[model samples]
Target chain A: MTSKQKFLYFIYLHRTGLSVTGLSLALLLFPLIEDNPYTLGLTNLIAINALVVLGLNLFIGYAGQISLGHAAFFGMGAYGSAIATVTLGMPPWLAMVIVAILVALVALLIAVPILRLSGHYLAMATLGLNFVMYTVLLQWDEVTGGPSGFSGIPYLSIGDVQFDDEFRLHYLLWSFVMVSLMLCLNLVRSGVGRGLSAVAGDEVAAQALGVNTRNAKIKVFILSAVLASLAGSLFAHCYSFVSPDSFGIFTSTDMVIMVVVGGMGSIWGSLFGAALITLLPEWVDMFETYKDFVHGGILVLVLMFLPQGLVTGLIDTIKIKLALRRRKNVAS
Target chain B: MLRLENVSKNFGGLPALSEVTFTVPKGQLTALIGPNGAGKSTLINCMTGVIEPSSGQIFFQQQQIASLPAYKISRLGISRTFQNLKIFPRLTVLENILTGLTSEGGDSMLMAMLRLPYLRHRERSLKLRALEALDRFGLADKANWPAEVLAYGDKKRVELARATVGKPQLILLDEPVAGLNAEETATVAEQLRLLRSAGHTMLLVEHDMDLVMEIADQVVVLDSGKCIATGTPDEVRCNPLVLEAYLGRMGATA
Candidate 1:
């Protein structure tokens, strides 16, 4: 195949089957070695969280917007779905759908005002909004169950199939994660992605080209929020409980770090970041007492040496050096 | 055709463009020439709806367009290039031009969200058009190269390619050849001549006297935010008022 065709083929395979194969391989190996469901359950949670991070990558990395309150939107989706299922006695699948739509609407409402401001001001606005959301989630006792959090959330099911067991939920979460990643990949490859890149590169230029910069920002923000909410709902159903801590400031920061460390503007990088961030704590648990120190040290090193994030920085440096060598050879 | 009547702009009591009036005829290249701070850019801004005039009317093709936004004005068959190069740095040369082609004002939100096949087809056609634009500017070979890596002259050429890719009826070129070497300047001038031959109407704001004299069918000289002279390039070049505005007392004698 020609190089271009080869590249496209690689992208196609990576988009469609790579995740499926990875999940299948993990499942095949998972049962033979381990019987513990807790480890598998946590791993599944990480995979779900990674999908949410992938969505945020589209907004934060590709669109170049700061979102410190992403977890709040995720929390909203979780709680929205939980409330719909428990309080309102709706079916789980229908409740999830309603929760996604409501989360997107809330995101739109928030974006209308916040998108007008950019940079640090935008960051602060999102951070403050997240804090307010956390307080509301805590104080709204009757519906949300207050600080104790919501309980008895129904397990997720579609038709006759139930995802109450750890393995079942793992496969289901993986399915959604793959779908979200594929959607994100396609979105970035489209004209909408080009517009977002233009806005990120230079807002004024994008405006001069007749791009509605404000509207684009709002749309992407809402899309990202909806995805986060979907993950939140899934998480709530998986655990059969919902809590304020799951959608707190720390959770938001964790998502941001995942996207940044993996690579900004790259969906796959966000996945890699999510996987590493999620799995590293488990590996460090062997140290037990020094787990936090090891995690903190890794973050510091990653930030200090690879500020553009790990994946992109390495790729750029290698490309530059190769380009320089090619130019020298041409001159000779 | 474009006309600006009684256009006035104020910055908290200081006048930037006060009662400025002018008309640019259809199918001709008109030069807006002025010394530093003569409100040349401000006039362009007002005409393009980047700044709202305090009291004035703008007519493009005899239609009132004074209150419209910049993008809306662009969509209505008017496009512009900036004084500072504004090419998307990370995008490829062809992609930059494709942006101009795909930037119609009417794509629906549903279409954008769904990634409709028709939009995809339009995008493919735009890419082909972008390639043709690159070829016209002698940049077809560099179509895949990142815009940021191009030299300043090539970047300006790419910028022009982007602006004109939409095939707009009227194009506003703000100092198109600024900061170019003589060779690159000649290339740009040749391209402008080619554009003019293709029956494109151009309103150029340029400081390159030789280029302006060579390409401009008509010249409008502005002094202190008002048009001081309007005539053919040679007529304006000889007019005492134009000379005085450009060089003061010595200009008349010279």
Candidate 2:
């Protein structure tokens, strides 16, 4: 290969790494460019949502599994951390780590039976799990603070550096997002990733090819839950609050929408999906009463025109346009 | 290397296959031919452990495999292609072939997630192996194209490449050339012969008489889920029961 061709090939092979590095750099510079706490706070929320979406996409997009109960895991992380730090008097970082591991174990227990159910059946089961968790958080009044919500949660810290404000919390949250992105990218390019794709494409075929479809589904399900739980911990620390209302069925549904709107099977799509969905209401604040109506209308339009999700659809459009231009040039 | 004895399958009191018996010798192409509803598919399903047999037993390499799941059967050196195309539509052709190597190595999910050096080496080696398989099937240039985008004939070849990529001890091909044109059928026939020459044991389920007669080392004919005749192609071709099964009794008499 020519030197130029070799360089381009190298870039193609490492595109995932390059893009991740670029996104991390952009994230690091965002706070420096904009000192507005409100914007940074929104971005931090986007990062937390993206963290969950990245893992969820692996299950939904790659492994071809459904889950409507991720909010439960997220809530588990928040409530677990809150209870550990406030009621049980554990350190903030220790609480976060311990809660994430506990939530993962809970998810594993739930996944074995639930992952057996596929399609809408799986979705319904997960939805039931979310409702169950929400109920527990509400009825367990003394511990969870019930409908009024839990408060007095401590800010996360590393030695002396405390994430007390949105600006400081932004770095912590985005770092998690970047790390998760890198791991997820690494996963999809590996052997297990190929097995997951095979399962997603056709479960029977995957089995015939020696892929344990059931096992693949359960593994991705647990991984997705752990990420959501970690994000839940971050959500609690960032806001210093926890509420059953925040981790209800609606939030779970929103995460699914982000995965779809961002594009299935595309990692970068997760980030864009989370950011767009989270910011949509804020952007359409002028039409307060018609907020949901406008949101539904836009989603319908997007699905109608770009069924592949925003990132993938947009990328395909650009490629097509470029190809057309190239053909015209060649003809001329 | 594989034996079946009195394997029967019933669905809701209706027998799809009844008391079927056969033995497939290793390092040879054994073609399973039958009329419609003759239970060819049911027999294949039983052999692959897609469904448990209603009665009797199946043995592969001296191990009873009737109760094992499909993946376990595959891992025990049995692989199969589908009647209808089941290629991973969204995945690239190379990735599709890589999936066949799942039972071989690099199975650590944690190592994959961590992007460890061992997995990186495994990925590269697996990719090279997949590319080699694609090359053998004449799909080398289209390795990066999504499996769905390939033409019907090419898709069949991709399935063949995938089934053989892992170098399984036994391959069950169901209508491998069902939708292909004459030219494509000839291509697949050549690949099958190559596999036979390489000493791979294959059970071919096909309807095309000429291709089977041309390439099969042994032919087993089924009529109403019973083995009517089994012998060399020329011998089975002249069997009275086989003639009666293919043509009606009156036609056979004529």
> Which numbered prediction scores highest in TM-score against the true structure?
2
| lDDT of candidate model 2 versus the reference | 0.88
Clashing pairs in 2: none
| Candidate 1 residue-wise lDDT, A144-250, digit = tens | 99999999998988788898998788778877887777678767766677778778878767766777778888988988888898898898898899889788887
- Provide a comma-separated list of chain B TM-scores, one per candidate: 0.95, 0.96
lDDT, each prediction: 0.82, 0.88
- Candidate 2, residue B211: lDDT: 96
**Candidate 1 backbone collisions, by pair:** none
Provide the interface RMSD of candidate 1 in angstroms, 1 decimal place. 2.8
In model 1, where do residues sit more than 4 Å from their true spots? A1-43, A286-308, A319-332, B104-106, B247-254
Candidate 2 chain A lowest-lDDT run of ten: A318-327
Considering the two chains of model 2, state its CAPRI-style docking category: medium
Off by over 4 Å in 2: A286-288, A298-305, A313-332, B247-254
Report the error of model 1 at residue B116, Å.
3.7
Candidate 2 on A10-50: residue-level lDDT in tens?
99998888888888898889999999999998999999999
